[model samples]
Structures are given as C-alpha cells and as structure tokens.
Target: MHYQITLAREVFCEGVGLHSGKPATVKILPAPENTGIVFIRTDLTDRPRIEAVAENVTTTLRATTISKGNIRIFTIEHLLSALHVYGVDNCYIEVNGEEPPVQDGCSAYFFAVLQKAGKKIQNKFRKEVVIDKIYRIDDGERFIIALPYDKFRISFTSLNEHPLIGTQYADFIVTEDVYAKDIAPARTIAYEKEIKHLQDMGLGLGGSLENVIVYNDAGWINKLRFNDELVRHKILDVIGDLRLTGGIVKGHFIAVKSGHQLNTELAKEIRQGGC
Candidate 1:
C-alpha cells in the first residue's frame, strides 16, 4: 500500500472514566505520515507523551492500555479499536485527563466523529509487522496465539462461567467494512457482582446500564447483538491491544479467554522476532 491516512480535522468527545470516575476530554488531531498514534497528557503541566506501544503498557486492570511518561491513563481499548479498524495511520490524541471516555463502552462514538471529519491520505506507504510463525502465551487458562497468515484474522472463545454468559465462540476476517458493521457496536459487559467489586475498589466509576451490558447470575438484562457477543468483544480488544505494535499486523490470532495482558505480551513477542 502506497498511502497512509489520518483524520481530515480534529474531533472531540467528553465523558467520565469507567475506572477513575474522573471526567475526561479527548481531542483527535491529524498527524503526518510516520507519526503513528500517540496519546498526549495535556492535563499535566509538562504534558507527557505516551506512544501506544507494548513497551509503554503499564497496567491492564479492567481494560487495556495505561501508558505514561509520568501519569497514567486507564481504559483506552475502545477508542484504540476504532482507530485500528478505521485504518487511521497517524494521529495525535490529546486527553485532558487520564482515560478516554467510555462512551457506550463501544467504538461507535469514535467512529461517528471520525467519519464526520473524513480522512486524508498521505504520500508515504504504510508498514505492517507480519507474523512468520506460531507464537503463544498463556496466563492460567487464558491463552493467545499468533500464527502466520497474510491477512489479519481473529478467532475467539470465551466462557463467562455464569449461567448468563455460558460459552461462546466467534471468528472474523479483519476488515474495515466488517468491523464497522459487525463489531463496532458491540459493548463491553460485566457481571453485577464484578461491577460491585469494581465500585468497591474505586473503579468502574463511569459504568452504567446505558454504557455497559449488565449481566446477572441468571442472564443479561438486555439482548446482545450476536449470540457470541462476549467472544466478539474479546476479539475487538485484541485488535486494539495489538495496535500497540505501532502499525498493522498480518497474522491469524487464536485466542482462548485471553485478556489485555496476554495480548500485549504476544505483541511484544512478535516484535522481538519470536513469531
């Protein structure tokens, strides 16, 4: 590919952080080719720059990405996912506080704002880190594997372990059209018990019925877009976490109950020539 793209103009959104309970504002600005996606902590006086890279990953408590040169931002997966699928080659995301807004706990808001701004293609060719072999990592029962493939692909399996979630399997061929329609609207879900625990820990401060699916021991309070929505969300997360590699990836991912920690580790492995 001889072209790279960025937003045509700036876009803005504001909301509270699900974990921090603090309000935040995010602004997206188009960047030149080779700039990549970077997060600027404008709330700080020094204004630290945090590259969305696996090496910068500091935490993965409830969601992915907590990189910082000084202060940290929490829960950046959904916004990052939107950027990845939308093929945003380079951009500067300035957050007035830690954490991007958990708008609806999905990528829909980011997509809408990005679509409205349109995209500008640059002259430089884009680059991708291709997987050349099978590389795997595991944490307890969770595991993620990257196998050689030409186009990006993902397969996921999740067992909610509750009567409500059961076990789910989902697969997708990664592409913009498929992501926009099939994956972008799927919201993050949580068990009521977990939500309570998160709240007790002073986390998930911004979680609500409107932004997240609340599942009880019995079943979901609402319906899901797909039968395997839980697994599909896991796939969406992998796409976002892998973007920390600083470019596109050409590989097939086989994930079994894998979370951000494992996904980030796999990206590091790939960069180290382990895959």
Candidate 2:
C-alpha cells in the first residue's frame, strides 16, 4: 500500500523572492500523517499558518498565491512541485517572508534539497484523487482537460506568438526520476519587452539572466536547457498547481496554453467533486 510520507529531517534554504525581490529563508520540517502540506509566515507576530490547498488560493496572476485572512504566501508553485514529485504528503514550510525563495527560477534546487532530506514513511495509507470521468475547463483560447488514467501524466501544448517559440508539445508520465532529470531543471521564461513592464508593476524585480530565461524579438537572450524548455516548465507549473488538491492525483491532464489560473480552477473542481 502507498504510505504517507514526510521529510526525514528539517532542511532550509535562502534566496530572494521572484516577485517581491525580498530576501527570505524557508525551512521544511516533518509533520505527522494526514497533516498535508502547510505554510507558516514566521516573520509575522502571530505566525499565521496557511494550508497549501486550492481553497486558500487567492491569486494566480504571474504566479500562485495562497492566503489565510490577511496573511498570504506568494510564488509557491516551484517549491510545491518538488514536494509533490517527491511524494511528500505532510510537512510544515516555515518562511521568513511572504514568498519562498526563487532558487534558480526552477524546481531543481528544491528537488535536490528534498532528495537529500530523504523521506519518512508514516503508518497511515495515502489517499489519491483518482479521476473516473473527464473534467474540462476552457476559456476560448486556452483549455485544460483531466482524463481518467492509472498514472499521473501530463500532455501539454504551449503556444506563443513569438516566432522563436511559436508552438511546442510534450507528454510524459510524471515519475520522480523523470521529474528530477527532465522537468525540474527547466527555468522560468520571460520576454524582453515584458521585463520592464513587469518590474514597473513591482514584479520580477529579483529576476536576472541567471534565474530567468529571457528572449527578444530576434532570439533567446540566454541558453536553453532543452529546445522545448518553455513547454516543460508549463508542465512543471501544472504539477505544482494541481498539488493544491491536498493529495496525489491519479490521472492524465491534457492542456493547451493553460496557466496558473486554469490549473488552479481545475484543481478546485476536482477537490469539490471529491474525485
């Protein structure tokens, strides 16, 4: 039987927030079975806690943000993606700021750290969300469809107007090994023309060439880890976003130009549907 798992020991990392640009440190600690993934803002006086679930998701602009009353956490997708892939069911993520560190703008660092921490199996059996029917969310141009499948999988098609990154497609059965080697290392992508506008809006201030892959009208400003890195990153985001369902999902997701908003919406639907 599949058992619930948590970190073997506490582990921590430090970096700057992708959007907030503020320096922050995050510590992951083990929790008991059935606790689920939770986040705590240690910088606040009350030290409010927010469970990482779809119901707490408040914003999905450029990133996913979860809130509990006035307290909030931002840009949590990368970290959650790593934890989900690692099969971590229960943990406490303690952070010194509103956002977790944007290490290398990808899940690779987080995945490596989690691997080093190892896993502790609990007595309780894990419950997974098994999709028995199709669930679809469409917004004209973009759409996401969840289909019944025995394994966790994703088939994504990314579309961009830029000639350099017009259309790309990829499908994979997301296993821990595949995620660590193929999906986790893909860095976040941004456009040169949008950088100034994003910074002006008080976002992506901490982003740099070392972390984000930027491209201009002519071509990419930074080297790509893969020719279809952008679509792979989209799959990474979808994995993280879906983890908000509060359990491992057993199904296949087919997406076309789906972003955080659509991903989270489908997550909420799945949760409410009790699938």
Candidate 3:
C-alpha cells in the first residue's frame, strides 16, 4: 500500500563540486509518478537526461557517476543518500555542471533542502525491491551482503591503519530522522598524505577542511561530528549507492570497507535478479 512520493514543489541550491572544483547550480523538481530520480544536464545544448539507476552507472572512481552516452554526472552519492532516506521516489535533478554541489561533503544540507520542499504522495504504489534471501558481493579486501529484513538497515565496519581511525563499527535502521541526526552530518574524509596524489589524479580539487575531514599521523585536522563518523559515513554512502536500484530496497545491508563499486554492483545484481 506504499505510495510513490515526490517533492511538493521545486527547490534549488548552488555550490562547488567536490572533485570538479567548479561552481554548479541544481534544481530539484517534482516529477510524475514512476519517473524515478532523474538528472538533466541543463548546461548542454541537447539537455540530455540520465536516470539515476544501476545500469546507468558509468564509473565509481572516487564517487558514483551515472552517464548516458557522452553526458555524465559524478559525486551524486551525498544528494542521493538524502533522497533515499526521505523516500523521494520521483524527482528531476537539473544541474548545470558535471556534478552536484558538495555541500559540506555530507547529506545534511541536501536533507535540509528536502525538508524545505516537503513531500507529496502520488497515486501510484511505490516500486519496492524486497530482499527474499541473502545476497553477497565480495572483493578480496572488501565485501557487502544484503539479508532479508522487515526494515531497511545497515551494519558497517570500517578498518583503517591510522591510529585515530583504526577500526569503527555502527548499525542503524535507515529512517529519515535517524539519518538527519546521525548520518547526514558525517563529512567525507581523506588522509593528508593522499591529498597530493588525489589532486595529481585530477580529483578532490574543490575539497577543503570546510567540506572534508582531513587527518594525518598526528590526529584529525578538524573536530568530528561523531566519534565514529567514518563508519557512519560509509553507511550513508551505501544507502545512496543502493538507491540506484531504481526502487526502495527492503533489507539489511552488512558491509566491511565497501565503497561505491561494490555498493552499485549489489544494486545491479538485485535489479537484474528481479529481486
């Protein structure tokens, strides 16, 4: 009996892309039922559209990127995370650049934007992918598993050699209020040693202490919103990546150091399996 939902009205925001280091403006507009979450590159002449679905995911270098032919958008996980938690089933995300605004490198700002716009229930029933059994995706060093559960939840383990962030774990039921308070404020993180290398690779160009949590061997360069913010941010990314499944997923996700690649792969598998 669950129904599709969209924004009650259109809303807009503007900021710099985390990796692109370019200013961008985004508009979130209500869409018809079943439209799902779609992105439009309004800066282009053709105004190409790319649906945020698993099959459209073209890359996961440092962030998830969905593409249609030559048009592409990256660093979308933060916004998508908020949308997933808000149960936004249909919307059109129009952007003038290749990525959405980084916005403190977390879902908090996006979540607030959703709050301002409000939600409207559509007539059609929501499309949901309920896990019936276990589904697993394993890489030698990282893994993600989905198990049948009545509610959407996540259990994540983050392992790092850094003394400050050695190993952290957290489990949470993915509710909008829980996400806003616990998950959305955890900013993206990076090590000081990796910054130069990442920049050399033409990434993280827009990153700063304001939007990213930076750490070195000594300690964190900035205060943490939560003691175990790293793991909680991992869970946030998982929620966002899995939203590419094109429907709301009902399951418990257990992950160990899983990133966008494995997250989207699991989404693709679930979608292809018709589960």
Candidate 4:
C-alpha cells in the first residue's frame, strides 16, 4: 500500500517574497496523519491557519494565494510543488510573514530542503484521486483537461504573443526524482513590457534577474536554464495548484495556454466529481 508521508523533522529557509518584497522564513514541520498541509500565519496577531486547498484559494494573480478571514499567504505555488513531489501529505508550513521566500523563483531550493529533512512514513494510506472519466475546464482561449490514467501525468502547451516565447511544450510523468530534476529548476518568468506595470501595481517588488526570468524582444535577459523553461514552469504550477485534491493525482492532465485560474477550476471540478 502507498502510505502517507511527512517530513522526518522540521526544516527552515528564508528569502525574499516575490510580491511583498519582504524577508520571511518558512518552517516545514511534520504533522500527524490526515493533518494535510496547513499554513500558519505567525505574522498575524492570532496566528490564523489556512489549509492549502482550492476552496481556500483567494487570488490567482501572478501567483496563487490562499486566505482565511484576514490572513493570506502569497506566491505559494513553488513551495507546494516541491511538497507535492515529496508526497508530503501531513505537514505544517509556518510563515512568519505574508509570503514564503521566493527561492530562485523555482522549486529547486525547496526540493533540496526536503531532501535534508528526509521523509517519515505514516501508517495511514495515501489519499489518491483516480480519475475514471474526462474532466475539463475551458475558457475562450485556454483549456485544461484531466483524462483517466492509472498514475499522475501532465502535458502542457504554452503559447504567448512574444516571438521569443510563442510556443513551447512539456510532458512528464509525476515522480519525486523527475520533478526535482526537470520541473524544480524551471523559474517563474515575465516579459520586458510587464515589469513596469507590475511594479506600479505593487507586485513583483523583489523580482530581479536573480529570481525571475525576464523575456525581451531579443531573447531571455539572462542565460537559459531550459530551452522550454516557460512550459515546464507551467507544469510545475499545475502540479502545485492541484495539491488541493490530497496530493496523489491518478490522471493525465492536458493544459493549453492555461494559467492558475483554469488549473484551479479543473482541480475543483475533479474534486467535485469525486476525483
């Protein structure tokens, strides 16, 4: 049987929040079976807890945000992506600020932290969502679909107006080794024209060439890590956002020009249909 898993011990990391531009430390701690992934807002007076789930998702702007009452955590997709890869079901993510640190705008650092913490198996069986039929979400120009499969898999097609990033695609089967190697290194990205608008809107305040890839008229502002980094990052995002359905996804996800909004919608639909 596939057992549930959590960290063997707590691990801590700190860095800059992509949007808040503030430094925050995140503590990943193990929890009892069935605890799920809970985020603690230690910065708040009452230290409110927000469970990581689609229903709690408050915003799908540049990144994903989950809220409970007044407490909200921003830019959580990267961290969640790492946790999903590790099969981390029961854990506490204690954040001392409004957001977790953006580690190189990818999940590589987070994956390393998990490796350091190690994994502890719980007696409880894992909660796996097996899709028996096709579930789909579609917008005018974007769409996401989950088809029946015996294991978790994903294929993403990215299309942008920019010539440098017009079309890119990535396909992968879910595994911790595969994710840490292939997905975690794909950084979040933005275009040259959007930088100023993002700053004026009070977003991406801490972003730099250090943490985010800036695409311009010519090409990527910095050296390329993966030729199709944009599309790989899209797959990373969908995996992170789909963690709401209890981690184990036993279906093939097909996404086309979809972002956080459509990903969350597809996840919600899958949950409602008994996954």
User: TM per model?
Assistant: 0.95, 0.99, 0.99, 0.98
Query: What's model 2's overall lDDT?
Result: 0.95
Over 82-163, each residue of candidate 4 has an lDDT whose tens digit, in order, gives: 8988889899999999889997999999999999999999999987878899988998899999999887899999998788
Write down the lDDT of every candidate, Cα atoms only: 0.84, 0.95, 0.94, 0.89
Once superposed on the true structure, which residue ranges of model 4 sit more than 4 Å away at CA?
none
Candidate 1 lDDT, 151-256, residue by residue in tens = 8899999876686677888889989888887788888888887887889988888888878888886778877777777777788889999888788788899999
3 versus 4: better lDDT goes to = 3
Q: Per-residue lDDT for 37-61 in model 3, tens only?
A: 9999999998999999999998999
- The runs of at least 3 residues in candidate 2 whose Cα sits more than 4 Å from the true structure, single-residue gaps closed, are none
Candidate 1: worst-modelled 10 consecutive residues by lDDT: 65-74
Worst 10 residues of 4 by lDDT: 242-251
The superposed Cα distance between candidate 2 and the true structure at residue 183, in angstroms, equals 0.3
Give candidate 3 regions above 4 Å deviation.
none
Q: Model 3 compared with the native: what TM-score?
A: 0.99
Give candidate 3's total backbone clashes: 0
